[model samples]
Target chain A: MPKTLTKKRMIINIIISLVVLLIVINICTVTGTRSISLSNVLKGPGLEPGDNIDYEIFSVRISRVLLGVFVGAALACSGAVLQAILKNPLADPYILGISSGAGLGAVIAMLLPGISLSFLGGLPIAAFAFTGAIITVSLVWSIGYFTGRSQVTSLLLAGVVINAFFSAVIMLMTLIVKTEQLRSTMYWLMGNIPEKQESFLLLSCGTFVILGIIILWRISNNLNIITLGEYESKGLGIDTEKTKIVAFSFAAFITAIAVSLSGLIGFVGLIVPHAIRLIFGPDHRQLIPLSAIYGGIFLVISDTIARTAFGQEQLPVGVITAVIGGPFFLILLARYTRKVSLMK
Target chain B: MNIIEVENLGFDYGQKTILQKVCININKGTFLGIIGPNGAGKTTLLNLLCGLLKPKTGSIQIDSKSIESYHVKELARKIAVVRQEFVPVFDFSVTEIVSMARTPYLGSFAFPTESDRQIIVESLELTDTAQFADRLLGSLSGGERQRVFIARALAQNTPILLLDEPTSFLDMKHQVGIYDLLKNAQFRQYKTIIAVTHDINLAAQYCDEILLLFPDQNYKFGSPKEVLVQEQISKVFGVEVMKGEISEKIFFIPKGNYIKNNK
Candidate 1:
């Protein structure tokens, strides 16, 4: 488990995983409430997809799948970077309270009347969520710096405290909403994949997320050195604070994007990186990219189950993930504790 | 020739002064050891010398250039350090861990080049850790792990090396073994080493000069024989000690109350 793969092996594995992800995406795109022919879907959708019901459904499904792909990849990569910077294996995007902050912002935006920004695909909710996430992270970082002896411990504690506070406020707001709005808000809170989105918006977010992942990839070597400890990394010529800020910001940014797109998809971040690290080794160079692909595969599969699992009633994608992730997390915790005991 | 110069250097944590008015000049290729009781700022001084901590006062010059003038990466290329042993957050392989020494030399998009790989291999061989290249660092024995760290420092290819108690948590054989490796590194590679250790005997044996720090922000610097006097040792350590010499190297045996009562 502690061994690393050779570069050749890593490349081969990535290529194989990419192929698997593509296959999963295709299967998921085809299987929905109304099953569509794989052959018809594979054929290029004409410019006027609206005229044909199948083509319209196919495009929507494909976009939803792609959204899942981007969100999943973003979360997993963010989790990997957080774990490295925080020096904690269990750290994920949600651990920093970004998800709660984004949720609170989304809830507040939904309650208010129309306030849209055309530049951000006319989604003021997303803008607010991103703002909320950033503000929460800044607050957490500041509080952590002043209160704790070590940055790692302080930030984590601050995140926990802030997360609790924000979640309570969000719940209170949810209770006050009318029954008609309550369903959508609750669904959003639980996390649902949107059936359709403006293509321009998706493209912009996809590009942003991909760029964030690439940036994290560029700093993979620095992440490797930083994991050795702050002073040790500094001695190795790293500006430890600068690296942490960069890593945390990018990780949080992408997580914020994912949270804004799809409410609060839980375990993709927490599970994918750990599984990849255990399998492929802890080298960030390989871990980051592999986690991105596998994370996509995992979420696409989960969303598909959420849509088609029961008859007619569509469950939120988050429900499927948590249903699966809860057990997976327990197993991971057990294995982690065993590993710690063995190390001791 | 002096490769490092510290003049009127001072450090403080909030209101409490840790070190003050310390001036010392270190020659190129000299093995200098810093020794003191706990809370005497040994590690702090080491941190300051490496530019990990900014000095509150005075200046440190490395190779006649101000230490602050060098960027972090530049300073790393000039000086390597091996801190006391601890488990790495991730269990990277021994070779993988050692190869990390090339961090300063790597560009943003670059992997290890041929020369970098060569240096890493040579460092592993020098520290006798080549056999464990593929093994996880966490699986190694304490002595082996220590050697792997030394190999990493060697791979850094810096002119100066600073270690903080490199032999702590080790038995006698491992202690001597690490010192022997460091001594050979000094003689063969002309590495300027400054190690902080409580083991004064090892310091006396391996270090060309010693810097003994006192809790009151005072310090004495000279050859071990000149600096490690009986009165100063007793006053600084708060213990009586019996000194012995063998092969011209001095060693101390603390005459604790338990020993006195037994006698």
Candidate 2:
């Protein structure tokens, strides 16, 4: 059973999470043939942009750590919002087909590198991916109209069908793309941190995350109302349709940004939110911010394990998270499921 | 003065018509109970009253203004509802649940003001749930949960309150306790209250007026004395209920199909 979330406990948990974040940042920076030493791990977290130090390796490591924080937070918060909007605790980018849809968009951007659209600016892939995810989420909800029941089973079915259909489209895209582009798309779809760590990418992603936090916070009260079902929310004078549209758009948009940058990383969205809910209870006011913080911590830990788990050859971070989160999901399913229906 | 006016109201679920041409005029401070058999659209009517559902055929006016003209938050400020079923997305505490009733009142990033806090406290006190305010809603008993919901509705602090079978999940003891609490709030607080109930005796004792929804978009609406006649009750329910009066309250006693069985 989950313990009650008190004010003091929430504060303590947040402080502990910050400490863990610093430790993970330390771990991410320490990379060499030699096993990580405490002192070595502490070395390159220093030196800001344009500062004097071993800027080459240290800067890349720092950038990767920042990327991990950004990607993880975006995905987890997206998951939390989706769960709230759908009124299903299990909804996430991966399960609702956002990742695959975004993956297809990113693949298209890569395949047609010469045919870049000017509107999306520097990150056309990210923009396309965002559009793809938003379209997919809306499609999934629209599909719910045909299913009659909007509760657990029908929503899951809608998500599952969209996920399956999108994956097939992505597979077809991969088959048709140029051989060189196919390899990169496969690596991305499998989930790996890309080599491009431009400061602007970091800045834009950071800005997005900050913006997401503000929007989510502003709507946090509405989220609580939404959880009690559409009638209750509508009866309370909450614009249920408006709240759902805004919240779900953010959820999918956030997931699309992460997918564009880090490939289609699964399980971070699902695993992190559920973990936070157990400790912090289900209030979106706490769940939104805490999930972002804990999401960063969870992904940094997983990414570190991915980089280090295989000697000489690094594993895609997505594989490592899946290996951990698949069983975690099964355990959750076995523990709580009266009916065995879910999206992968 | 009529706080709410429904004119020629009608609705349908899929192909089947639930209520049609139903008219009701409720004055301020009246306790109204809606009673009907299964599938008679008791909840459907409640939804239309609260603006959760738009009427298919007619119009509803609140304080002489059309229901369609009111904004969501504006309507919420004027009226509040406690529905029959709820599926909480998270296992939030009772305090959290009750505090959510302030959603329409509070602006973004606004905490409840001191006045809001006082009302919440009074609401919990009214429902006798102040002692369990900090407890998680999922951990509470059915009766306790129902009271907490009523407390939440009270915190809405609207001129009109609506509930759909508020005591459906409760035991007989708690059922009566809830109606008693509603009765006290009606006289003391002067809030216009509407509820759908299966318990005729409780409704007869508490509600000033009752609305009965029958099949095929038909309805019976009037004061308890006008609507709860023996023939009307038998016609709507399809059951023979022997009635007896105790002082001011009308009580119902069910008489099984002994004549049919004997025949």
Candidate 3:
């Protein structure tokens, strides 16, 4: 291939990525309840005077959509970084047991009646979830580091043990909690985006975006070498241990933030990067940014469908994502399995 | 002057000793081949010299500076190593992989400069992989892949290049091709190339110096004429060479080899 052609193809890929993102965002923004036209959606949802439609569009719907976008992008980017560092396509944002740990923490926070004083209003579920994620990831990282093997297998095994322990705690809490608390806990676990203040969503999303960018940019080179295996990467002058530490820490931080905001949205992280790899190849210089954009687009579309598919009752975003992403994941797994078998 | 020096180096994994008190020196623009049978610490010694592992005792120096004192990027700027058994999970293009050799010279967020691209292209051309610059590395044959790796080291354009069993999986034709390329690169470009190989014939044919390691705590480090003799071969490998040549070209025929008899 000529150098000019390579440059041209890269430019084309970038343009295609931008176009796809715009199309998906537009499709998501226009396809809500009250059936806003494309022109009206573009002109601004505030064109009408006496409808209270603008409040619903800008406040409730757009905020929720943006929240889903931010969380999804964060989760997917984290997954890409983890997969690259760990050199495992099966890695995901929740691989470190973060979701289960956060769930347990949220359940514990809910069960303590006097803890309402600390939260000031009902319960700060996000804070509890964040703390749980941090603690679990820190523990897993420490275990992996102390084992002296810095291999993906050790980290994954530690994650599995921690995940099981946290899950047991969540199950125990579920059995003992009151019915009302149980109902709320179950709802949270099902993963719904509540009608949050725009300011809160912006703050959380902004922090995640900033941190995600820093991580993606910081370890791009390490991520490249890491895919070549640890020993090989070390020969190439990469500090494999240091790179792994930074990559996993960044991944854990982003996963924690995403789980805090969205209450354990499932499979977006696992599916988005895999899909992008199939389409755009696995170079993280391209993969990371593409995954972020595609993840955001995917979640926005999925959330919009969840919200407006029914007239009065909104579907849980998790359910909608599972419905779409489950089949997609199965298809990918089947394809990969077939390829492997053929190779054999 | 010696570009690399190792003194009384030893390493062990828990209870299993891999290398014992090893000493060697590599001078500038010299091609040194470390040869031994399997489990003779050939790769281990290369790994130690490349700073991939810390010796249990003693030290390594590059250009009279202790290897421990050099930052990874600083050492990388002076030396490049290509190891065997590298598997890339991603499908990076050949050009992209080769350009990674310039990483030590790059800033945190900087992309490759024009000169870096030219270096990558020239390296690819030198390795005869310029035609495959846009191909994904995962799609290449083993020989092609090995050449691509060589191209990456060449793109680094450092004074020294280290390779671990670079020709292990290559066909004879590609092996010869790689040797020819390395020979020219060493003499023409003045690269100090250190390679670990089990092929004594290839080492004898191309290397300026051979470091022969034996499993029974012994080693011979010298020119091919000194190290590739019948007695040394019998001692290190426990095999007799019935006939050998050391005049204009060095060649050896193992005992009871019918092919050599026909030749």
Candidate 4:
């Protein structure tokens, strides 16, 4: 409990999580469908991506790894921020119905033909999904403000109502339209990494993830104060209302970008923050960055297992994340509560 | 000089008026206590003074500047507040909470400097929470947690300290302990203090001046001896009380009026 001890421990954890992330990324590249040796994947810029067999496969795997890093980091950090602002440990990007709202948009693009062929080409789904997420979140926020003093409880309830409504819209579409035409949409809803290189998407999502991390980190101390409760934080000189608005908007921004990149990926947001919080303390300074790193490592591992575990048929990465993360989270929570009790 | 000046200040929540036409001036280095019955708007008035709420009418000036003109951090640097209700959600260490008092002085992203650390330690020590510095907030009892919160306010090192029923739910020992700590902070540090307390006797024993309020817009502000009388107590609270004096300090004892009503 000494001051130096806590700081030193935090340093060690950061270093350890970074090292583990690198190892997970390397292992993911080598274990994918087309096996590429670590040497080629690790090689410098001498070899071009489209030049040869190992190079092409390595390039695809590398891009997938990059996608996982951006999407995972964004979702996890957003979850941490949301949890603090909403004062709910269970809150995440999904709480605002972003995932399901985006699902409806993606489903429309899939079931309704000719729309995808517009100037957006295949990217119509991403554009529509982003729009859907923003619309749904803003609606929830407006509802919360309309009902009362912009209470977090009202916002949470609004999110639940919107999420259910979006789910029904998706279901109605499913029942009326045909499933054969919506194969990719179903897979996307189930969560899968981008099949192609998607370098442009990767770059945009990377910008969001990096910039979001920096912004959230600077206000990390504010997040800590906020967890103390709104009035208490304000008493300490924080403009609690302004901070809440900015933090929630930024969280929603990153989460929207994450959903647009990879369809409805779940557990990275829920379980990664919880996992990091368990290992490290609840200080957002630690929670934000550590969750980002651990989240990337976790998704990389999950995606690797999805592609390799079934041999030829690739499972949706979302299923893999939930299947693995859900049980792991339960076990971590059990051990965590026991440890906390023991500390007293 | 007056540390805080309110001229015909009034406030309302939605359409309901809480305080109206209230005027008061709190001088520097004074121990001011606000006592009232249930729903007397003491907390609301305290909230307004701390810039948590904007008055619907009139002006409140702090140190010759209007409260609305100062930024939150600027206001915090001048006045630190101890909240009455403390909820333990996170397991943050006592040191962490106490050090947060320096937040108003530091930049948005800055960590504590060496002097900030010294002040935090001193604050914790003065509040008798230094021993529990490493303990998580959730691990402490209500009294211990209250002390930790007070330490946080002390760490702000502001010229004025505002407390909202800080000792309301505590046992007698902890209540006196907190009051004594605050008194020392006021007398030794030469800080202005304003506490909203429902306990009448505690107000009589500690405060230099007491502001009495009713659910209506009426208020009485003066020394404890002038403000707290049998007539005001009976009229405001609808309860009978007996007043006693011992060791040159006044006390209030309830006459069990509910028993009389039942009879």
The candidates, ranked best first by lDDT, are 1, 4, 2, 3
Better of 1 and 3 by lDDT: 1
Cα displacement (angstroms), candidate 4, residue B195, comes to 0.6
Q: Please, what are the lDDT tens digits per residue for candidate 4 over residues A69-149?
A: 878888898999999998888888799878888888777776666653123534777888888889888999889878977
DockQ of each: 0.49, 0.41, 0.37, 0.55
The positional error of residue A240 in candidate 3, measured at the CA in angstroms, is 2.7
lDDT of residue A256 for candidate 4: 88
Name the DockQ score for candidate 2: 0.41
Clashes of each: 0, 0, 0, 0
- What does the i-RMS of model 3 come to? 4.1
Better of 3 and 4 by DockQ: 4
Global fold similarity of model 4 (TM-score): 0.94
lDDT of 2 by residue, B155-248 (tens): 8988899988888878889989998988888888899999989888888888999998886567888888888888878888898888999996
Q: Chain B of candidate 2 versus the native chain B: what TM-score?
A: 0.94
lDDT of 2 by residue, A34-92 (tens): 44455444465555744434545566666887888889999888888888877777677
Please give the TM-score that candidate 1 achieves against the real structure.
0.93
| Collision pairs in model 4 | none
**Colliding residue pairs in candidate 2:** none
State the lDDT of candidate 3 residue by residue for A1-344, as single tens digits.
23421335555776787798778765676566666544444555464664545454654556666677778788888888888877888888888888888887777777877553125432376778889999998888778768866557888899999999888888888999877677767777877666564465467556767676567756777788778886666656777778777878877887787787677788888899988776666667667777877888877877887887898678878888889988976787688646634532
Error of 4 at A235 (Å): 1.5
Which run of 10 residues does model 4 chain A get worst, by summed lDDT?
A1-10
TM-score of each: 0.93, 0.85, 0.88, 0.94
